[model samples]
Target: MEEKLTDRMCPNCNDYLFYMEYNTEIPYEGNITIKTYLCKSCYYKDVSIKRHDMEKPKILKLKIRNKNDLKTIIYRSPDASIKIPEIDAEISPGIASRGYITTVEGLITGIKEKLSLMDSHDAIYIEERINNILKKNSEEITLIIDDSSGKSKINSGRAEVIEK
Candidate 1:
């Protein structure tokens, strides 16, 4: 692993901020670069990850039947589009989007957090429905990931992959 740190001017304030970059290799996976920015003056932070290897476009689908399914690991690339059709929720890659690996439950939680930020009536309703699903009180949900970079994957035998 290699790491670097530099000072940058904060966008909110003219104060100096810390910019960090790291390059690391994961076993069975390719090399990745992680970049982070932190501004102490404005308490702002941002993080993103990029894979070094090129990949083909692909789509992944997974069904969540029970609590055990929530523990399954999911790797999402920055260019991937995540969709939960049951709830009519979708997250597409954007300028501020970042790549990360997390469990199914964590993904739902992340979605809830984003919805909460919207402060809209529809967002709140969808968030509540997602929470019910997370609690296993609702019907099973399906997770679909369309990755143009093909770096995203669901680490489970139940996951279906289709090359685009």
Candidate 2:
């Protein structure tokens, strides 16, 4: 892993901000670069990731059933689209989107955090459904990821991969 820390101006506060960059290799995957910005004045922060190697576009799918499945790791590229149809939840790549690696449970927790921030009836309903899924009250849920960069993956034996 390579790390660098620098100082820059924060876009939101016009104050001195801390910037960090990391370059590292993931086993079985290519090199990845991550950049982070943090503003001490406004408490603003941002992070982004990019892969050094190019790959063919592909789609991956995984089913979450038992507690063990929640431990499955996921690598989401900056150009990937993540979808959980059962919960009507989807995350599409955008200009501000960042890439990250996390477990299935971590992904669900992230979605829950976003849902809790919304103040709508639909959001409440979805949150409840997601809660049930997390608690194993519901049936199996499928996670589908479409990655244009082809750097994303569901690291599990049950994961299905399709090239596009």
| Global lDDT scores for all candidate models | 0.84, 0.85
- Which pairs clash in the backbone of model 1? none
Candidate number of the best lDDT? 2
Per-residue lDDT of candidate 1, residues 1-164 (tens digit)? 33334567778886776777888886324898778777877877777776688588999999988889999999888889999998787989998776788999999898899899997899989999988888864878899999988889899999999999
Tell me how candidate 1 scores on lDDT.
Answer: 0.84
Angstrom error at residue 50, model 1: 6.1
What tens-digit string does per-residue lDDT give for candidate 2 at 1-164? Answer: 43344567778978876777888887535787777787877988877776689789999999899888988999998789999998888998998776788999899989999999999999999898888877874868899999988989788988999999
Of candidate 2, the 10-residue stretch with the lowest lDDT total is 1-10
For candidate 1, the 10 contiguous residues with the lowest summed lDDT are 1-10
Q: Against the correct fold, how does model 1 do in TM-score?
A: 0.71
Clashes of each: 0, 0
Tell me, by TM-score, which candidate is best. Answer: 2
